[model samples]
Target: MHVPEQIPDHLDFVGRGWHPLLTRLHEQLVAVSPSYSVQQVKEKYGTLRIHLYTGMLRHLNLGNTDWPDPDQAARYKDEDDAARALVHAAEQESARTCEACGNPGVPRDRAWIKTLCDDCAGHR
Candidate 1:
């Protein structure tokens, strides 16, 4: 796998295609943790994840990306649950929100599964 040259604290590890959604997510995280880092980003079951899970994967939204605190999600413990919850919440938001226009969108399953706004849907 190719690694990124650097991982910015407040920026996303994904691409510009998801800027609208990611920017909003970044803003939300800044309100809580300014130093948060995004570990990954891609359309769920899209080109990114398809290299691993296919045939078995029928549905997907935005790609799965994790917030900071890697070990927090390993197992949701009493104390770690809160942290994991925050990360999960953000991820779900990305799945539901539009990656282009930052509007409410649903997962589109055409050739690839992607979360998009009505206007931006299939426009790519």
Candidate 2:
């Protein structure tokens, strides 16, 4: 797969067609908060899967730091919500996009389920 330089190498496991989608999502996350980091990206049940992390979540995990005050916390929550919405949109788009060639597609069932265009499905 031709992984984009902006994306981490570990996420290259996902299909090439979704690279643009991933890249756009990454850019959106960065705009929301540069601290956002993608932990995983993959294909599951013929759809794209993405996992992400942020410093705010890490702070919460530490359970010791009152890192952000109430006002800041509310702002962070809004940003997080926006990020989640973006991810959902990307995943929904993936369902209709060919995993092999980025064309319009639908989920297909064989030995394994995959989202593919008619042409790409024929070759498989």
Candidate 3:
């Protein structure tokens, strides 16, 4: 994971770490790049940027962000976009489970829908 210096304060060190979904995605995209290298990971307005984020990420075109090569930036545009889709899917999966404890869950009616395990869903 290569999180940019500019990120929401909410995303501390823990957010920079690769989530289980990302680990799996990276393994799957080895053909594209030996390993995924994110150029940015930030929350826009209803979508995530470069990582699987079930918590806080937004986009006008949700799940359509890019993850260009940190070094080349645009050399692997297609490949990065493909990897970004995988990450997006994982984020969507997170919405159906608990981000805190990873248990079966459903969306709660808030300004934004967030899925949480029974134990972690309480009062959220």
- The candidate scoring highest on lDDT is 2
Q: Model 1: how far is 103 from its true place, Å?
A: 1.0
TM-score of 1: 0.48
Error of 1 at 12 (Å): 5.0
Off by over 4 Å in 1: 1-12, 15-42, 46-79
Writing each residue's lDDT as its tens digit, candidate 3 over 19-46 gives: 5544565566565544344445543322
TM-score of each: 0.48, 0.84, 0.49
Ranking by lDDT: 2, 3, 1
User: Number of clashing pairs, model 1?
Assistant: 1
Best-to-worst ranking by TM-score: 2, 3, 1
C-alpha local distance difference test of each model: 0.46, 0.77, 0.48
Per-residue alpha-carbon lDDT of model 2 for 9-118, expressed as tens digits? 54568878778777788888778766665667789989988776554673464464677988877877887788788888999999999988889999999999999999
Better of 1 and 2 by lDDT: 2
Q: Worst lDDT window (10 residues) for model 1?
A: 50-59
RMSD of each: 10.9, 4.7, 9.4
Candidate 2 off by > 4 Å: 1-8, 61-64
Tens-digit lDDT track of model 1 for 54-94? 11110111243544254543422322343345455656766
